[model samples]
Target: MRHHVILRVIAKLGIPFIVLFALYVQFHGDFGPGGGFQAGVIFGAAFILYALIFGLDNALKVAPMNLVITFIAVGLLVFAGVGVARQVSRLRRARRQFRRRTASRHPARRARSRDHGRRGHDRDLLHLRGPGPVAVEFLIGHYNYWIFIFLMMLGFYVVVARGNLVKKIIGLNIFQASVFLLYISIGKVLGGTAPIIIDGGGPVTYSNPLPHVLILTAIVVGVATTALGLSLVIRINEAYGTIEEDEINDMDQEP
Candidate 1:
């Protein structure tokens, strides 16, 4: 790798852009597509590329193990902090609304609040009725769900049937992708645009952003899982001279 000057130079040039893209994803996630997990993976990947090109020792020098661990802890804290902040904000809003309603001396305001609550409950009940009768529109609209099911089953079959460790990891990734697709499909609403409202925009349906956010976390987890699995496979290969599950089992049975 030291002799590969062009490769090293290209990596050096590309790594910064990769990192910048990751930042863009992290910051723009709230308004569009991207999130913290995706950003973290991309950031980590830049380091990984650097390691592959410059050697592990150099990579360690650039990002020490202690520093990596610290960053991971900080990330966890940030995620937890955001959740805590949101929960606290929600509680405060609820408390303020309750107080506002209680402080109102007008009977009409209290009646209106009660009526609104009843209407909300009724809406929930109506939702409980579930999907309407199946039709061509429903089937065509749910094509993404069908893709999810197919990928899920294919991945499941591969995981169960394949004897190679690498194949198993690939299957897991496929399964993870299926889950991502499912979440994205669930988030999308027909005729809904991105969840953004312009000042002068008329009433518009917005796709749910929560599922996309959650998927970003899942994507990070999937990346970590894949990396860990591959690392383990490498270790297993070094120990047993093969990555086939059956061969490994046979070797273990021999002694």
Candidate 2:
């Protein structure tokens, strides 16, 4: 069969279920591995395929760039905003504790000194040290979520602020890459050996391995999504003679 003919058949037969399955995976992520990032790409791909078969205009009408951009930004912001909120809450709690400690004591100066001592101790508790593999692993796993948040913000800023289509795609890639880091970091185990088996009779502590496998799949998916997104950008530029989003919007509005 011709490529277009096959695409039409696939579009008719597969798009609906593909979308449904994407939603399933998205919601099911908390229980298992798959999550919003994977599901969004799959959902995006279904529409992208439709766009390829029917036309960009029709697909955009179905899922406008503005809406898709909103989806992307909202997902990232939810993730990062949670981290920022947590940090803020922690700081507030610390301040409250300081106030209570000072108020509980009769002598304010001694209370202040005691509060400062407690604050220093709290800082020390937060200070993560190396040397122990387990400690390092714990620190990395704990902090990876924050790193993911930062990366998401960076990616969203790039996508929203940049004019170049390629740069936007790069931002999208970075956003996806951050999630991959999160998954992989969580999978790490202290003193865990590599997945490969050694020839000699050596003891080995293996990591969960699931996160690594899942991340590998995610990386492949990310690459495919990025390629497809770039292709669409190229097509958009070809059809409209400009890839700058603002220019495209203006062109669409021109009567």
Candidate 3:
């Protein structure tokens, strides 16, 4: 009974704070270095804590698998949609700029073959390099945050929605792996190579290696957590002869 009381206290107090901290990490990531992955883990840890204290059913009621899946999907879609919008806007602006430049030229000057060819070539190149597209690419960098967000959501959905415990672990692994993409994306610089100190630092231009190193450590932690979570699932299945969350709840319901 004392142990039960302790669990209730943790559920009431600890869980709320964990969730609040996760949001802080998520939003504050842009200013510092952390972002979605760190936030996801913190958020996941809160649910995990709740599950430990009050059982999975109650935790699911607070954050249903469907809702979690939706959040993950929406986050990714928003990121990608922004990129596409920027590309379109850039193309329109470039076209307008090109037309304005051409219209201002004298007829005689425009007729000169060499000048015309050069101008046309330059205009074509500018059109090809649309400002919106470039700006979007520049804003997001190369790692593709949208893809990462999608994978993260996919993983989380699988973990929450699946009845099989092992499948859930697999989903968690995918979710965590997605963060690596975000880190890699942000750390990339144009014309930069790996940060390895080989041959007296040839060309001196290289991407930051810190995010990669940090992600590697995060992956290790993710793996450990997955293993532990899976083990617990297996034990739960063995004890109750069911892995479906609803069934487990029914079994645990008071007589």
What is the lDDT ranking, best to worst? 1, 2, 3
Off by over 4 Å in 2: 1-143, 198-203
Cα RMSD, model 2: 14.8
On lDDT, the candidate that comes out on top is 1
Error of 3 at 242 (Å): 1.8
Which residue pairs collide, candidate 1? none
The residue-by-residue lDDT of candidate 3 on 196-215, one tens digit each, is 44455434556666667678
lDDT at position 214, candidate 1: 81
Residue 232 CA displacement from its true place in model 1, Å:
2.7
- The global C-alpha lDDT for each of the candidates, from Candidate 1 onward, is 0.80, 0.76, 0.74
After superposition on all C-alphas, the RMSD of every candidate to the true structure, in Å, is 7.6, 14.8, 17.0
Who is ahead in lDDT, 1 or 2? 1
Q: Which tens-of-lDDT digit does each residue in 182-239 have in candidate 1?
A: 9887666567677654667665555666677788779879988999999999999999
- Residues 34-131, model 2: lDDT tens digits: 48778987987898778888788888999989998998799889989999987777876787887787664324244234334544422343456656
